[model samples]
Target: MSKRTIDYYTKIGILTPERSESNYRFYGEDSIETLHLVSQCKEQNMPLAEIKEKISLYYTSSVEKEKLLKYAQVLSKRMEHLEAELKEIKPLLDALNEEEQKSIINRMSPQSMALAQSLIILFN
Candidate 1:
């Protein structure tokens, strides 16, 4: 989408982007997804006001949706951090034998294992 269009959307409170200290706006996955939704609604000949209302309804109609969005954002950040850490340790991990790998896995807490599995499922 064009920067002008995004600025317009932000002005109308439809596509909120994070603002930096320098006043630069940074759009994330949610904004991209919102853009896709707006495009689809427009393709269906929906008016912009109606599209805005629909988007608001989709977001506000359910508490679960709000919570899920928050969780997803948190998980996305965690995944990014974990990816960096994994990149640093990847060579070390590759050097380990199968038994060593299994031992490391066995030493991890169940919650960590579950979180890793959930992240795998979420991204895939």
Candidate 2:
């Protein structure tokens, strides 16, 4: 928990802390948990390299799950926004003649067309 210990851990790649523009390092919840893990590992006389490997394994799964959850949240928000836009535009689209709708669809980029189709399929 001491600054020197943190410095050593950072130097050895065991603990990574965010640094400010002025170079002050900041530790958060993750760092606190890592420090506790390191202390426990050291108590059992684990080598630094081994402890680092263990922490890397821990972070790999944890970070992947965090990234996936964040992605799902962003995707959910995007889907909600898309639904709202579609609702607002539905009346206008319906008023268009078949040829006009075809013209609009033709003007869309292939990727956009594909995404629209995908969204339609998803909603149905």
Query: Judged by lDDT, which candidate is best?
Result: 2
Where is model 1 poorest over a 10-residue stretch in terms of lDDT? 115-124
List where candidate 2 sits over 4 angstroms from the true fold: 62-124
lDDT for model 1 comes to 0.77
RMSD of each: 14.0, 15.9
User: Which pairs of residues clash in candidate 1, taking residues 3 or more apart in a chain or in different chains?
Assistant: none
lDDT (tens digit, per residue) of candidate 1 on 1-124: 8889888999998898988999988999888989999998786566777677667766775656665576567547757877666667768977999999899889988887796667556544
lDDT of 2: 0.81
| lDDT scores of the candidates, listed in order | 0.77, 0.81
- Model 1 regions lying over 4 Å from their true place: 61-124
- In the range 11-120, model 2's lDDT, one tens digit per residue, is 99999999899999898999999999999878756678768876776788556665556656755876777777776787898899999999999998887789777876
